[model samples]
Target: MKRGIMLLVVATILWGGNYICGRYLAPALPSNLLNTVRWAISSLLLFGLLSMNHKRLPLFSQWKKFALLGFVGIFAFSTLTYLGLRSISAAQAGMISAGIPIAILLFTPLILKERVKAKAWTGAFLSIIGVVILIRGEHAANGHSSIVGEIEIVLSCIAWGIYTVLGKRFGKTMDPLTMTAGAAVYGTLFSALSCIGTVRLNMIHMTPLAWLSVLYVSTFASVGAYLAWNTGVKIVGAGRAAPYINLLPVWTVIFGILLLRETVSILSVGGGAVTILGAVLASL
Candidate 1:
């Protein structure tokens, strides 16, 4: 349980870093194309890494599991997030993510039949309130977009919750490294098919910084964070592990302010503390 909690916290922190890298690339690259390149690179790297260690691939039946995992977890989550980010304000996205932990908490019991305690529910509630307060001071500043973007972000959140529950189910049958890599393989295929009209390889030109961002996302975000998240879920079940997601925004703010020249407010600091406390209570 302790190890699982630690791994989840680590995964959420890495995911926060992922946001920064992807955000840097957002203006320059189309969302679909960005999904394709990052997943393609991560998939190849994972395959090579597994081959070096003679790691076994999933069986034929298990391929379906991985593919489904890829579809919702990788393809759906990534595509929808980028699509929404294209139009949604950062503040809005941040607020929306506050629901993910609670959604996963509610869905886990229904989808995976996992038992959840009252304490967990309370913790999720507190964390959500913390999230609302955390981003309260940060204004939209300015924005203009249709409701389509809002719908996309909401779907992305639902997809993410499903991914976490499903990942735990898959982890019961296989090691997480193999699960992560397999999902990447299928995600690469899915994203490639989706990129036909969206991503233009002929016009590709990446500067050193852009390339660095890609490397960070493909390696750390795709391979490392996913492996940790899957393993953690397997260890603790989706119910206990879900609250760690609250850490994503906190980590994003910390990393963003430190590396990307973003700002944080005093209220946000209190929110981070409450968020962590809530997570701690839920996991206990």
Candidate 2:
């Protein structure tokens, strides 16, 4: 249990760092190309780990399923995140992402035929209110937020929610590592294809810091965090593991201040707190 808790904490921290990395790379790299490189590297590493663990590769017959997962979870979510980060601060991005659980809850009733409780509904309401507060706070603090960026981030969250629902529907028999590895392979393919006409050779000429950010996102944020999260979920069950996600924005805020030297507004903090509370309530 303790080990699981530690792993979850580590996963959240790494994911928080991902927002920082994404923001750092957004200006230097094309979002689509960067996502392609990130997932391509991640897929190779995950494939190597899958082989080392003696896990079966995804079957040819399962291409459609994995492709769907890859498209939504990896391709859409990641690409949109990078595009959004180009305009929004990492702290704002993280706070917006904190509403993903609410998005998932909204999807569950339609996808899984699960009953939505009143508490969850209330939580969703609070999440919306929190987002409004966050947006207003950003505006009040000198128009720091972009409407397009916020829309992209929200869409990314929705895509992720759908991916989670679909994963639950299709991946009941597969282990987490197998599922992640399979999805990543197809996701990398999609990301690479998206970059075909636009990818430039000069784009590969990254500075040391950009290269480091790429390495961190591809390795620790993508593969390592996924492994830790899946293992932690297995040990502690999804319900218990879910709440640890609330720590994501908190960590992102911390990392943004320390690493990115980004300023966070007080109202943004309040909004994040409200969002976290709503997510907690929804999960219960």
Candidate 3:
């Protein structure tokens, strides 16, 4: 249990770094190209790990399901996040991403054909209120905040919610590693297809810092964090592990201030707190 808790903490921390990395890379790299590179590397590593473990690759057998998961989770979610980060502060993006759990809860009914409880509805309401407060506070405090960026982030959250629902529907028989590997493979393909006309090899330029950021996102955030999270969930069970997701935004906020030198207002903090609370409530 203790080991699981530690792993979960590590997962959230790595994922938090993803927001910072995305923010730093947004101006330097095109979103589709970054998404392609990120997932392509991740897919190779994941598949190699699966091969080392002597697991059968599911891509051929479950191509359709993986295609959908890859499109929504990897391509849409990641591309939108990178595009959104181009305009929004990492701190603001972190706060907005706190609504992901609420988005999942709301999506459950529609995607999973499950009925939501009143508490979930209340939690969704609180999440919406918190998002509104966060947006208002961010707009007031930072001139960089963009409504379009915020919308993109919200859409990314929705895409992730749908991905989670669909993953659950399709992945009951598969292990976490296989499921992740399959999705990554198809996601990389989709991202690469999206980059065909727009992305050119000569146009891509990166400093050492940018390369390091890409490595961080592709390895640490994408593969390492996911493996840790899946192992943690297996050990601690999903319900116990769910709360740790709220820590993602908290870690992102810390990294933003320390690494990115981003500022946060009192209202933003308050709003983040409310958003996290709603996630907690919704998970229950």
Candidate 4:
């Protein structure tokens, strides 16, 4: 259980770092193209691993579930996230994304018919309040912050919540490796289609550093972190596993201060602390 918790922390930091990578790499590689290449690499690597193990992939009966997972988990989540980053800072995106646990908690009773305790309700409410403060900070920091961008972030969180709920339904029946492989394959295709009009093949003129960012994100952040997260959640149970993701906002704040030299206001720290505390409580 401790190992799973540690792995979850590692996954959250890596995944949060992807936001920094996306912010830096997005201008060089368009959002759709970045997403396309990330998923393409994931698909290739996972497929190669499957071949090496002589494991037969998912059958036709499971294709539909994989397709839904790909659409919601990868396509919708990645596309909207990249688009949101175009307008928001990586730190702000991470902080706002702290709302995902709240989304999952709210969706629990409605979608999963799970019982929620009074303490959990209080935690969810506090988390929502923290999110609102973070959103206000975004506006105060950037005069041009748009409501549309905030909505996109919220929708992306919702997409993930839907994926989590759906995963509970299908994940028991499907192998995690096969499910991830299938999602990557379908997501790569969907991303490729989405990029046709937005990014050109000839537009890949990124610097070596940018290329490094892309490679790091594609390999470790997208593939390795995801596999670790799934395994960790299984070992520790979802409720215990979910709160570790709140670490991403904290990591993002650290990255922003060290890498971008951005100011970390008391509001940011206090809000993040309250938000993470609320998330931990809500997940109980």
Candidate 5:
């Protein structure tokens, strides 16, 4: 259990670093093209690993599930996030992320047909209120802040929640690795098709540093972090493993300060704390 907790802590930090990478890349690179490269590289690497192991993916009959998973988990989440990160501070982004469990809880009843208790509902309410506070705080302090960016981040949260709830249903028949690969394959295709125009017209003459950022996000954030998370979940069980993701906002704050030189407002910090507390409550 200790080892599992350690693994999950590492996973959450790596996952939180995703925003850092997106923050670095969003200004210089086209979001769709970067999204394409990350998903494509991750999908290819996973497929290659599957090939080496002589493991086959699901048949074509499962295309619907994979497609939906790919759209929500990869295309929508990454695209909307990068678009928002272009405007919002990484600290603010972390605050938004802290509310994801609440977003998941809000959708669970409709998607899973499972009702949560009143405590969870209250937790979700607090999380939404926390989000509002965070947004208002950031908007007042940051000149570049926009309601548009905050809205996009919240939508990204909703997309991820949809993917999570749907994964519970569509992922029952497959192992974690297999399910991820399945979603990744369709995600790669979707990103490729969506970014084709951007790739052809605007994807030229990027600096080596930008390329490095793309590679880092593709391999470390997408592939390594996901594998670590799945392994942690296997060791600890998904229930015990999940709350570790709340660590993301904390790690994001740290990295945002050191790596990105972002300053966190007092209200942002308070809202983030409230948001994390709400998520923990809802998840319980």
Candidate 6:
């Protein structure tokens, strides 16, 4: 239980910072390219870690499914998220991305044919309402806010929903480390290819701050967080492990206010509280 709690905290912190880093770094690095770099770095790091354990890469039979999982989870999600941060604050992105658990709850019933409690739907709806309130609150204040940013994040949430379902379907048979490594590798390749025409190679022209932000995200957010989350989750069952998600937006709100100097209204706080309350009840 202690281990699970620690992991949950670590995952949320890394994830929150990832949005901030993307926002800081996006000006210098194109979204797709930034994602590609992080995945490539993470892939190499994970491969080295796995190889040290004398674990050979999974054979061809496992490789194909792993590749697809990586594509959807890493490639699709990261690409859209970084792109979204181009116009949104890291805190705002984190808050918006907080709706992911609700998406997972909704998708599980439809895709896995699992029964959902009424409380779960109520929580999910409340969370969606929270997201709507937060977005409108921010947009009403700024004309420069990009519609594309919200669209990208929303799609990223959908991609993340797909990733979670795929993980549920395939995780039983696949070693998590191997799955992560494979996903990072293939996702990097795909993201790179996707950005071929748009991504600039001249990262040297980027400010030192941007380079540092990229490296931090690649090392800590992408690689360290992934390894930590898998290990932490292993120490706890997924069911008992799930409800920690309710805390993510709270942290995002705190961090956003403290670090980013982002404005938050009473409505956002109310919405976030209601959303988390619903998630907690639903997870119950």
**Per-candidate clashes, comma-separated:** 0, 0, 0, 0, 0, 0
Model 5 clash pairs are: none
Model 5 stretches with alpha carbons more than 4 Å out: 1-7, 196-205, 231-241
**lDDT (Cα, tens digit) per residue for candidate 6, span 1-284:** 79767986787778777777776787687778788878888888888989898887774667787778778889998899988888887666766776777766777777667888887788778778877887776777665777789889878987876676666656677666877787788888889898867765685347887888888888888877766665555566444445665555666666767777877666656665665666566666
Put down candidate 2 lDDT per residue, 1-284, tens digits, no spaces.
Answer: 99989998999899999999998898679998898889899989988998899887864778888888899988999999999999998999898888888877888889878888999889989988888788788878857569899889889988877776666666567777887888888888888899989878776557889999999999999999877876776677554666787788889888988988998788977887898899888879
Report lDDT (Cα) of residue 64, candidate 4: 86
Candidate 1 lDDT by residue in tens digits, 1-284? 89989999999888887777766776767777778888889888888878998997864668888898889888999888777766644434544565677667767888888788999889878876765565453333223443576567668878898888888876777788788888887887888898787666654657788888888888898888998898888888776776678777667666667777765556656665665567556656
Q: How close is candidate 6 to the true structure, as a TM-score?
A: 0.90
Error of 1 at 135 (Å): 7.1
Q: Give the poorly placed runs of model 4, Cα more than 4 Å off.
A: 201-205
lDDT computed for candidate 2 = 0.84
Cα lDDT over the full model 6: 0.74
Ten contiguous residues with the weakest lDDT in model 6: 233-242
Listed in order, each prediction's TM-score against the native is 0.82, 0.93, 0.93, 0.92, 0.92, 0.90
Q: Which parts of model 3 have CA positions greater than 4 angstroms off?
A: 1-5, 200-203, 233-241
lDDT of 4 by residue, 143-220 (tens): 787667777777988887776666655666765677778888887888889876777767776998898988988888
Residue-level lDDT of model 5, residues 13-127, one tens digit each, is 8878889988888767777778887888999888887888788987377888888988898888888988889888877887898877876677778876886898988888888
In model 3, residue pairs whose N, Cα or C atoms come closer than 3 Å (at least 3 residues apart or on different chains), thus clashing, are none
Overall lDDT per candidate, in order of appearance: 0.75, 0.84, 0.85, 0.78, 0.79, 0.74
Pick by lDDT: which candidate is best?
Answer: 3
Q: Which stretches of candidate 2 lie over 4 Å from their true place?
A: 1-3, 201-205, 234-239
